[model samples]
Target: MDVPHPFDEAVATVKALAPAVRSESVPVDDCLGRILATEAVARIDVPPFDRAMMDGFALRVDGELEEGITFSVTGTLAAGDAPTGSPPAGSAVRIMTGAPMPADTNAVARFEWCEESTSSQHGTTAASASVRLLRSVRAGESVQPRGQDGGAGTVVLGHGVRLAGAHLSLLRTYGIAHLSVAKRPTCSIIVTGSELCRDTEALLAPGQIYGANDAYLSGALTTDGIAVTECSYVEDSRDAIRTALVKAVASSDFVILTGGVSAGDYDYVPRVIADLGGQIAVRRVLMRPGSPLVAATVEGAVVFALSGNPAAGFVQFETLVRPVLRQAMGWHDEPFPASGRLLHTVKQKPVRHTRILRGAARIEGGVVVVDTEMAQAAGQISSFASANCLVRLDEPHVEAGTVLPLRFLDGALSSR
Candidate 1:
């Protein structure tokens, strides 16, 4: 049967129910991937002084690099040491990379460009001898003046940018030890099934399987930069679902219940949600693998009920749950989703709902192409591991080489 909720509308509805995550001040070391809440202004100039860009001699020059000019080597300047004295036009100081250039010196020539008279060119001590310049350099050569990166009060980072390692390095360069960043939205996962077991080391009985939903959901949430506050499994009882959900809603920003949302007698998540005063935002999405998806909101938190099938839940979390969580976490939705060319023909029964298939996508020679594997079934969990995208094919017959719509899985979106 065709599902009632359209995919686009379902996404919009899910985002509408997402709670806004708050911001907090945290140490720069812990701010990786966190969205900045405010502009990060440079407190001081980067490098903070006229510095040497290479291990070379620092001296004054007027024009293009000229050869055969010689100077008396007075002293060596280490990276952290203060310059002993400035060299006049006829002399130079052997400077190390990152060391401050001596005053009145407008250029630094590496030891490669000159030869020491009697001293070996290798050592921390001064080269007390006359040096001959074998290479010529223009004025200001290899010299990085102060404030080349940014002066104080310059906006080194703007608000809403996700902090990466490079960003933290800059923050550290300016002595910014702390950062103001948005906190990840907190959520809870409630796995509802009687045949699931959490103990992996124990022997399993006939009807019991190792619990996959809770662990997978928790990992997915963490990878998306969301905080998983609770993850618990419940029996196939309405009361059990209700009790677990009530606590989850009160304790977190959202609740995700895996299983028990469909029309089967064992499915009680929908009824329990309504009994708990939660309004059902969506009952069924027009997308296969997760057509039985259900959404509701209560107690200032949205509740998502996914299918018992592992692949279904995986797809739903990637396409539906992740987009909402990303929005709530203060990130922008991808304006233009990447697409892939079909590498093989796909045949499925005709239906009104959109079909979501797991496919491996790759870009070769500037073209995006995708292909499905043998394990592309709703109950199959292995198919998703190799797949980087969910190909959205609305029609029954998809021919090879046909361009199909696709959405890169959470955290896997990349520009072609």
Candidate 2:
């Protein structure tokens, strides 16, 4: 069967493969950054009861208080205390923030507006003292009612939502101890090339170069929440390549081998994968710098073979591998549509595929602006180092002032 375009086909393949990672019930604290597989319904109201909005007197006002009035202090209510009965007539309850409001109380008089007897207005203080109201409050004023955030059975977290710190706080408020999150997938990567060396500390031979693809891929995988169990390096020999590929596949849900996807004399990844009972799903892509990108499926897992060149593999990872990996983790959010205006000029000859140029994205006024002058070459590591985003250009030459969508990598455009 014919494969669809790389960008689309890769995603479709992932989605059509095994079902969304199995849902594992885990302690809420352990599920940070994991994809939520089920809707988190509140077993009870978020606050569970009407709570005080501030540390002040909670008064039951049937109608707007036309004038300030002093009231007897009925009792003090702390955060964990249950609601007391209705306040004594002409009396008020001193409540703290997160404390349950007294029954029949409609509003709280903040301390700033309340003049009380005694040096301090303590909630646990005796009722002998009184609070003088500086201003009149209407019914329900300053009172947080039950179910203000959501009532019982309301969905606080929808399915497929990525969990974060704030989300955890909300769930914890409802006493949710465990969550059903998508199971994390295991991944392994292979770095292939005779010219590559693992130890940066050692002196290099004339033809030797420090391999960076492994580090780059590992960082990206970790950031996306995929745990890499094995990261191995192999020479360009077919035997070495085949051995690493077979072992990586045996233990990981996904395998990534950098190098050998191209047609160069030493590029043997494609043939090795085919010989090892794998089918090449995509040999080329509609993208610049990473056009030689290759994807395949074996036994039921996915394999990505990227260009041996550093910059080329980097682009492929950003443009293609990330989205596929996210999808495999059960997240459906697309990653390539974010946009920013060009802050500088970038010129390039037209090509059959899209191009990704590295740069920094900054917010000017209200819109996002991308600067791309330093990202003209693929092999320059400094370009990727200083860049916070990548500008995707489909046109032959993008002018200086054109507005284009950008793929932000360094959280530079998050605030924008």
Clash count for each candidate, listed in order shown: 4, 1
Cα RMSD to the true fold for all candidates: 3.1, 3.3
Q: Which candidate comes out best when scored by lDDT?
A: 1
Candidate number of the best TM-score: 1
Q: TM-score of each candidate?
A: 0.90, 0.89
The true-versus-predicted C-alpha distance at residue 245 of model 1, in Å, is 1.1
The 10 consecutive residues of candidate 1 with the worst lDDT sum are 407-416
- lDDT of the candidates, in the order given: 0.83, 0.81
Model 2 misplaced stretches (Cα beyond 4 Å): 1-19, 68-70, 111-134, 333-335, 414-416
lDDT, candidate 1, equals 0.83
lDDT tens digits, residues 1-416, model 2?
23335455554554454335677898999888999988998888866788888788888888877456988887888889887489888998888888888777888888888888755535885343788888777887777788888888988889899998999988988778899988888899999999998999999999999999989899988988999989999998999998888888889888888988888888899888889788776778777677787788876668889887899888888777777777777887454668888876676776666777887888878878888878556677778877888778878777777988778887755444
Model 2: lDDT equals 0.81
Once fitted onto the true fold, the runs of candidate 1 whose alpha carbons sit more than 4 angstroms away are 1-3, 119-126, 203-206, 333-336, 409-416
